[model samples]
Target: MPRYLISFEKDAMDHIREEDFPEVTKAASAVCQEAEDAGVFVFSDGLSYDDGDVEHAVVAVDGMVTDGPYPESKELIGGIFVVDVPTREAALEWAAKVAVACRCAQDVRKFRGPAGV
Candidate 1:
């Protein structure tokens, strides 16, 4: 089995209003449940984009400690699921389901180098 990361950028969900979040959450949760029942789900979570979290990011270089994510990339990982599936097609199918549930595009990529490879 190969592991794939199905993810989306934070801005992808920006169009979703706070009032509509519950519906979106329900849809996304359904997809996660489907994946779990299908035995493909390994782990998944949505990253926090709160200003406090980002502002407090610790950066260390040569024992020097600093705060904040250096370079400050415009995009951030909004959500991700690690799934162990039989093939790329299977992963894509899962991604499609997720995209529909989240109402956003998904990026899918396989993990590097299988065990002992």
Candidate 2:
């Protein structure tokens, strides 16, 4: 089986409202359950923006540690899921379900491991 990553992209400033989040969460949970039943879901989770209490540190060229997102942008990865599936088609189906649940653009890509020397 191959592992695939399904990522949601959204603007941090234009965050989803708390009231609307539950519905999305419910939908996502349902999809996750479906995947689990099919024995494909490995893990899934939503993430907060990389700001405030989300401590981040960056090392500069001179070995100076800086704090914050590097080259910050309006959009950030909001959530993701890692699933083990037998084929790309299966992974794509999962991604479609996730997109409908999250109500956002979902990017699906095959995860890579360490390069063979």
Candidate 3:
């Protein structure tokens, strides 16, 4: 088994209206529950992107702290699921389910090194 991260960018869900969040949350939660039932889910969470979170992210360089993200990057992980799957194909299949549930595209990548499989 290998661990994979299935995630989406914050902006990827920007097109969704606030009123639709409940439904989207419900659908996404259902998928998470399904994964849990299958014993593939290790963790799942939605990251906060509010002014107090992303806007206030700190970067440290040579012991000096800097505010905000790297100047070259604007995308942020909106949500993620850490799953222990048997193969890349299985990870992709899970990502597909997450994409449909969240109504957005997803990015999947395996954890590096031993992955604690």
Q: Could you say which candidate leads in lDDT?
A: 3
Ordered from best to worst lDDT, the candidate numbers read 3, 1, 2
Each candidate: what lDDT? 0.87, 0.80, 0.89
Model 2: weakest 10-residue lDDT segment is 48-57
Off by over 4 Å in 1: 54-61, 72-74, 114-116
Candidate 1 lDDT, tens digit per residue, 41-115? 998889886876744465557676566555656767889988999999999999999999898999999998567
lDDT of 1: 0.87
- For candidate 2, the TM-score is 0.78
Q: If both were scored by TM-score, which would come out higher, candidate 1 or candidate 3?
A: 3
lDDT of 2: 0.80
lDDT of 2 by residue, 1-113 (tens): 88999887745214668798889889999999999999998999866554474455667799987765566555566688889998889899999998888877678899775
Q: List the residue pairs that clash in candidate 3.
A: none
Off by over 4 Å in 3: 54-56, 115-117
Question: What lDDT does candidate 3 reach at residue 3?
Answer: 92
Ranking by TM-score: 3, 1, 2
